[model samples]
Target: MTATVGALAPISRAACVGGGVIGGGWIARFLLAGIDVKVFDPHPAAQRIVAEVLANAERAYGMLTGAPLPKRGRLTFCASVAEAVADAQWVQESVPERLDLKRRVLAEIDAGAPAEALIGSSTSGLKPSDLQAGLAHPGRLFVAHPYNPVYLLPLVEIVGGAATTPETIARAKAVLDAIGMKGVVIAREIEAFVGDRLLEALWREALWLIKDDICDVETLDDVIRYSFGLRWAQMGLFQTYRIAGGEAGMRHFLAQFGPCLQWPWTRLTDVVDLDDALVEKIGGQSDAQAAGLSIRELERIRDENLVGIVQALKAGQGGEGWGAGRLLKEFEQRLWAQAGGGAPAPDPTAPLELLEIRVSPAWIDYNGHMTEHRYLQVFGDTSDALLRLIGVDFAYVEAGHSYYTVETHLRHLGEARLGEALTCTTQVLAVDDKRLHLFHRLFAGPERREIATAEYMMLHVDSRAGRSAPAPEHVLAKLRAIADAHAKLETPAAVGRAIGQKTRLAAPV
Candidate 1:
């Protein structure tokens, strides 16, 4: 059964095959952020593959917000292909690089998948036309090629065949957008798509040079990386040339070098083929350079660089990285993420103070949970803020040089994790010339869950003598009025079993 478009039916979950590098990356990208995932791979290490994916996902998700992720999504491991794609709205197939293997997998997905579901082949070479050759419905099948470490990189190439519809492309774009990815639509289905085709052409030429003994491996790599690769990172071939040529532009540069195209210069594509000896040479050189570093070590280095570079770009644009920035803006409009109305407008008389205060990382402990000490510290800050409203503020404490924490206690209720914002509300309880008692309840932000509470007896005193002193007449009168008004007001349920001599539990006993 299908739901109407845009009807807030549950999130469109995905299924992936061949839980290797590419499949693992997809799971990391989607499932960690509360999107469901299903995987089917005959390999025995499929579970390990997904666990690695989840680990990478946790890292990526942690970078997005100062606080923890909303909620983890569901992931199911299916024993067979049919079970994985049974009701999945999207399926990503990443089996071995064999035409027959892909054709069979597509056939299985076509048979069991819903008619509206979109199926993508993560093949680096096979064209969409060839992959969908024997499919039951070729229209739903397309090449949704993703780069390695797909969760970190935002670019996805969507190559469609003759049967593909505009609506299908639109839906694919929406899915990519939801997960903070940029989808580029390739107008026609071509072999090896854009990025791969460009790299393959370069590879063919590099192989030819090494085979002919014209240059060494390191030399060729250095030439490209130090020269053209630097420019290409920010701009493509066409645009880079346009800038180089200046006002004369690409036409001028092409006119100068167009004749060189006919010269027997380099046969990167048609001229040189991947013979065995050349492959061995390249492999030996690669191993020599790589030495003995584990994949995990390499991945950590890669993530650090990606984070740094992307963060720089995002910083330039005021916090929206290239792909994620677009999604972050759109996410703000989502109802669940936004603050709703009818929160009993702020009371200006007893004004809820502290415009804003951020909870820091240091407040967390070795268990990776928020330390209990911080709970009282934040509530104390809130109480101090409320005290300022009635005139028993810093000036009073500084002049007297003494303040009392007479009755201070906290109920250890729920746990708060690292980087979580802890907030508290102070409601005036009772006030006298000598003692001002206040009640405060602390809550974890974002979810608005209650964490702890503090009932304090603040004494105003003289700084020179460190002895209890009555507050001034004006401050005393204002405190009395506030306490009188709030005396009839109710307290929240977080206040456990009446503390000291106070009994203002808002709810029924």
Candidate 2:
């Protein structure tokens, strides 16, 4: 009873069972991808909970990239599982951990869903085989484990049951990819899958440390956050250790540290007892660490931190930072495509109004104004919008050509407070086959008060060759059209201004 590769159609609508955190997240991901979602949860407050999660997802996704996203799809809360799966092309079951509850819910979903639709279980550790045991069409049922905050994180582990066909897995992967997710298919179905197995091992060790008084929860967290966590974000444990081998690689590193495997450094073999006293101690410590903040407040803090980390990874030190960064880049391109292929028809008679953004809390400095570097970021995004308008885009850059800013002059006229809405306008000052000169103005508030101005000289370059190059004829034609239109406008006062003292002193001897 497996859905053939051709049987699975593009998922324009989806059904989600049990609107808890995980289920709600799946709904958010689907809706954000512009897929209408029908959700069924027995809890009376399920709609409120799902709405809260959706709001957070919307905020996080908005901050994650400047590329436009598709208009949000409608979310329908259904009274019954049958109604939810009535017209859905994809059915996602995210009930409680109890096998009996899950089995019952999945059976109901299977009974109601379309025959060609694929069914996925959001089980953290349950094997897909067990979940599909008594199902009428077990071949269509598989585990699709997603991390928390599913809309933001791209990874989803897809584990097929014994009856599951490769075509089913391929269909699942295709659907996930359409929503900007990386679906890692497991070669075999196993308990806990991959990510949670590693996580469980670390969790056991962290528990032992706390029980043995070796380190408190906060201290243990700090150790990871300040040390190997950063390295792991970019290079995983193996690659990080391979670099430690210096000139040699993984083989040499393994040979040097292989003996450590026999050491008594880990408490993985034994389980830590969660006694009353230990539980109390851990709970007390956690409460103190939280400092009386509400759960919602803590969630907000965590989300902001995650956003900052992902953004840093996206920028990386060089270009692509880590696995997560690469995924973020790919997701941005998808968003660009959804937003009408990133093509903007600039009104060349006036400055091109390219971007409007609100200052995020993370961008605020100690003085309560947007940080200096963030201004540059806004200008950079504005430049990207301009490039997109003039036939320079991801495909153009992928072809080994792009514009590199050779010089920039920035003038700060006013301050942007946190949450202040701002807009950016760009004007083509001049253009040539190899160079582009542009000016940008940043305005804040309803009155559109000027906050900053930037002038940039950008050069077309063969990125692979690491040298300047002439713009392609098609691109040059677009730029020329823009320049011709812009030529009719008056030159900006800041265009050719240089930073200097008003009255220059006499030349030094």
Best candidate, TM-score-wise? Answer: 2
* Candidate with maximal lDDT: 2
RMSD of every prediction: 14.1, 5.1
What is each predicted model's overall lDDT from 0 to 1? 0.69, 0.85
Model 2 per-residue lDDT tens digits across residues 62-107: 5566665655677998989999999988899999888998999999
Q: Model 1, 388-439: lDDT tens per residue?
A: 5555544555666444677776776788864355556677777777787777
| TM-score per candidate | 0.63, 0.86
lDDT of 1: 0.69
